[model samples]
Target chain A: MIPIDYYIIVSILLFSIGSAIVFTRRNILYVLMGIELIFNAANINLVAFGQLDPYLNGQLFSMLIITVAAAESVVALAIVIVLFKKLNTIDLNEITQLKEK
Target chain B: MKLIEIVFFFFAIQLLSSALVILFTRNVVYAAIALMSTLLGVAALFVVAGSDLLAVVQLVVYVGGVLILLLFGVLYTYRDPESYFEKKHVLLSIVTVVCIAGALLFLLSDLPFNYPQLETSPHDATGITKRTGYLWITNNLLVFEVVAVFLLVVLVGAGWIASHVLDKSKKDV
Candidate 1:
């Protein structure tokens, strides 16, 4: 079996790249995808560490994480839909009404 | 040189490359497809780690549910696709990512985590799925209930947020 350390590296890489996606992307939809990437990165870490335990707590935690992530995305997409309708645009750059003048 | 090692390497490579695609792609359609690849790779890795149940959950929820919803959302908000990525910060973001990954790798390498190197993962263990279900009901029951309610609230809340507001606005117009 591969050492648990390798999984950590992969998780870290996924995490940093996911952050890059969130940081650099302007589209609300692409940002959501990046958030999903970040979520999966953590899930990978949990599943990897779950191997050390007999009860599989890590897998259980990851299951909950996945469930919440799905629900979160549903609400986010709903907001995106409404935002598109109201503003006629979904670009994060252009929707800056919240910015102070 | 073992099959397990080969498959592990495949998961690692596919995950990293597809994630990079999500980072760099300017086209939203290609980025969405690439996210699908990344999610599939994560599911495979879950199987390799001996959790077939979570692997399947990852598939049904992420690839089937989330990706499709994203595609539908994209269809609704269709525009001439623009730079999801910031062209100006390309080099800066790359440098930041490299720094963060390097720092995390360095920090994580020192953590003591000792486990048996099982030649065959417990992937084929009998009744693992059964055990998972039992444990959920027996031990993690609270999480099960809360998420159930959470999803219900989300369903109604999302409908109200997405639909009801639009109707009021349309009436006003």
Candidate 2:
């Protein structure tokens, strides 16, 4: 049988990688992808623990999370497209025209 | 030794490799493709871990819906891929890596090594589908309906925003 710790370890690794990508990447879309990665990591953990419980609510919640993620991607990608058209660049650094340094 | 063990090992490798490729790739399109692979591997892992519903949902929502939208976003906003290299922040990247490593170390320290003793037989465990279906329709039906409605709204909103941006850009040119 596969151990639960292995799942936990994979989750942590994916989460940390996602965090790293979010912090370090300049592309706003990549940052959003990183956020998705983090969400997936959380979903993995939830499903892993859900396997332990008898009611399977964790599995249900994970499905809900997947739907929410799809919605989030749509909205976020739309915003990114609009921003790219207005500025002609999607780099996070270049989009700081509104910021008062 | 068993088929399950071999399947788990292969899927884990695929998940880790694809995830790393997604992170390290310089091309946005390639990274997106790698992300797809990672998502598929995760879905497989979900199946192995006994959440068949989640596995199907993961495939449909993430791979089918989210990834297509992401690919559309990338294609719509095409810039020179190599032009993105000018704004690298070395110090912040180092700090972020160090902080993540520290957190991972702390989490590793607290994990219990002993596996929990679960008593459900394989045949009975496979009956999760019937149980989950009853729970969904009986008590959680409303939440499911709400999510479907939310997805519809999001689709309309995204289409509107993208088309509006395209029209304005055409007028500008």
Candidate 3:
């Protein structure tokens, strides 16, 4: 069996990449993709930790996370669609109408 | 080298590099494809880690359902096939990535984790699946039903907002 440390390292790497994409990307859709990556990294951690326990509770939580993530993407993409229709662009920087001028 | 190590390395490399491609790719379509590859790699990792049911869920939900929705969302929003990346804040992203990595390494190294050696104990994959189903019905039933309700709400809410936008667009036309 491979050491769980390696899996943790991979999770951290992917999480950092996801965070970087979220912070730097102006495209709203790509930011959502980055969010998905972060969700995945967390899932990896959950599954890895579940391997340590006999009850497999972590795997159960990871399943819940996956379900929530699917629901989140549906609602978020719908909002993105509405934003694009209203603003005519998916650029986050350009869609600052809610910000105080 | 053991076969398990090789398989682990293969999935890890595929997962990381595909994710990097997703970050760097300027084209939305290509990025979506890369995201699919990354999801597939993660599914493989789930299996390698001995969670076959989660692996299947990862494949079905992330790869099949969400990725398709994302691709449709991408294509629906943009008429200009080429969706360029936001490289204006690359310096900020680099700094953030470094800080996050440092923090993660610091935090990860200090954690005391005890991994029990289950080498002699052979666990059946099918048994795990059966136990998971039993858990869902017995202990985790509430959470399961809540998620179902959440999905229903999301479905209705998404359709509502989408049609609201369409109605306004039609009115303007």
Candidate 4:
């Protein structure tokens, strides 16, 4: 039988990769994918805990997280599209016109 | 090894490989597809963990909705794949991964590892579905309604923004 630690380790690795992508990627879409990855990592933890809890609240919370993630992606992609059209590029490094002086 | 172990091993391999592809790929579209595979593999993991509801929602919301929108956004916005490949920051990414992994290891290392004994009863598929629906309506009804309304608003807003941008671009051209 595979121990639960194995799952936890895999989730940790994924979460770390996602965080790296979020912090280092210049592309807006890649950053959004990173956010999705982070959300998935949280969901994995929720479900793992749900397996132990008798009431299944963790699973319920994961459902809510899924819904919220969907809405967030929709709004974020819309913003990305608008930014792409305006700047002709989606690289975060190039869109620094809003940087504090 | 048992069938469940074999299935889990295969799923874990697929999940990790797809995650690596998503992180390493230069093409945005390919990364999106890799992400879709990764999401599906995670959903399968949820199933293995005995959270069938989470698995279904993960499949429907992440794989079906979020990933599709991401793919469409990439197709509509980016024209050249090579353009995205420029400005590689592999060293920074590796550093970030190492630091975050080290921190997470420190934080989670002391977590208890006692496997709780699951009280097994007859698996009533219908019971889970029925209870989930009841709980959604009774306990989380407000949240459910808010999410539905939020999704509708997002749909309208995105449509409006997309068309407005298209029209403005056309005028400028």
Candidate 5:
């Protein structure tokens, strides 16, 4: 079996890539995808660390996180669709800022 | 050298590279598809970590549910493929990614690498599903139930928001 360090390093790399995607991408859907990547990275860490725990608390929490991420994506994407319909574009910079007339 | 080690590295490559593709690919559809492979690779990682249950859930929820939603969003929103993908601050993001990775490795290098070998057998003797179920109904029951309530709320809220939009558009007509 490989050391836990391998998993940890991969998780760190995934998290970094996710962060980069979040910051650099202008498409809101890609931004949502980046958020999912970040969530999965954290899930990997939880499972890897849970392997060290006899009770598997980390795994339980990982399950919780998975459920939450799924729900979050649903709501966020719904919002994205709504925004796209109203704004005509999903580019982060192109979307008009909120201001009252 | 070992089979498991080989599998782990294979998935690790799949996960990392697909993630890179997802970030760099200009085609929104290609990026969405790349995310599928990335999630599957992560599920394999869970198996390597000895959590079969998590692997299955990751596959189901991420690959099946979330990726589908993302692809649908792509289909529904973009009329012209040219305008579908937009990236900003490329060089800055690259520098930030490299800096973050390097700093993390530097931090890791300073820490002692030794870890105590687990006392138990390599695999969990107890079935994780059973244990997870027990925990779900007992200690984690509250949180688990709360999640259910949260899902219900989100479901109703999404429906409400959607119908509200339709009503407004109809009135505008």
Candidate 6:
């Protein structure tokens, strides 16, 4: 059996990588992918802890998270589509509707 | 030391490497494909951790639904196959990530999981699938129903937002 620390360390590393992706990448798509990585990291944590619980609240929360993430990705992609349609680019920095004239 | 540990390490490596691919790859589609493998690796980890239902959900919802939607976005939004970041925050992000990860690892070093079902099926062990259904109907009925309604609303809203009507009106204005 693997120790819980393995799960913890792995998730932590993933969370960090996801954050790095979000910070470093200008492409909104990459940002979305990073967000997903972060979500999966949390899911791993929840499932790992769920195994120890008889009631399995952690697992239930993980299910909820998966549902929420799916919805979020849909909405975010739709927004990206619209943004591309209107602005013709997906780079976060190049989007400047709110920038001062 | 054990078979499960080896399996766990293998998947951990797979997940991280593929995720790194997403970070490093310039092509949006390659990044998307990497995301798929990273997710599959996560699902494998879920199975290794013993939540079969979650593994299936992760596969079906993430890889099937979100990945497809993302690829469609890619199709619609494909300008050049390649775009590069103008200002590289790579060093800053790396430093920040290292600090954050080191802090988390430090905190985790002391924390321990007292209850371990990792080695054996428990005395009152019931199938997670069965318990999930029961919990939905019994304890978490409100949450389940609300999430259903939320999902419907979010999808409908996204469709409306992306539809031609909004596009037409904005063009007219």
Clashing pairs in 4: none
Writing each residue's lDDT as its tens digit, candidate 5 over B84-161 gives 443455576688689878898889879986666564423477647777778899888899899999989988897777
Write candidate 1's Cα lDDT for B120-151 as tens digits: 54645572588789989989899899889999
Q: By DockQ, highest first, what's the ranking? A: 1, 3, 6, 5, 2, 4
Q: lDDT by residue for model 3 over B125-149, one digit each (tens)?
A: 3546887898899988999999899
Candidate 5 CAPRI level: medium
Of 4 and 6, the candidate ranking higher by TM-score: 6
In the range A3-72, model 3's lDDT, one tens digit per residue, is 7788899999999989988988878888999999999999999887787666779999999999999999
Candidate 1 clashes between residue pairs 3 or more apart in a chain or in different chains: none
Misplaced by over 4 Å in model 5 are A98-101, B79-81, B84-90, B112-115, B119-123
- Model 5 chain A: weakest 10-residue lDDT segment is A92-101
Window of ten residues with lowest summed lDDT in model 4 chain A: A92-101
TM-score of 4: 0.87
CAPRI band for model 4: medium
For TM-score, candidate 1 versus 3, the one ahead is 1
Off by over 4 Å in 6: A98-101, B110-118, B121-126, B169-173
- lDDT tens digits, residue span A17-76, model 5: 898889888788888888999999999989887887767799999998999999889888
For B7-52, candidate 4 gives per-residue lDDT tens digits of 8778888987888787777888888989988998998887777667
lDDT of 3 at B33: 94
Model 5: residue B105 alpha-carbon error in angstroms: 2.1
Model 2, position A20, has a per-residue lDDT of: 80
Supply every candidate's count of residue pairs whose N, Cα or C atoms clash at under 3 angstroms: 0, 0, 0, 0, 0, 0
As for DockQ, the candidate ahead, 2 or 6, is 6
Angstrom error at residue B91, model 5: 3.0
Question: Residue A78, candidate 2: how far off, in angstroms?
Answer: 1.0
Best by TM-score: 1
Off by over 4 Å in 2: A97-101, B86-98, B111-115, B119-124, B164-173
Docking category for candidate 6? medium
Q: Taking the true A–B contacts (Cα pairs closer than 8 Å), what share appears in each candidate? A: 0.79, 0.63, 0.71, 0.60, 0.56, 0.72
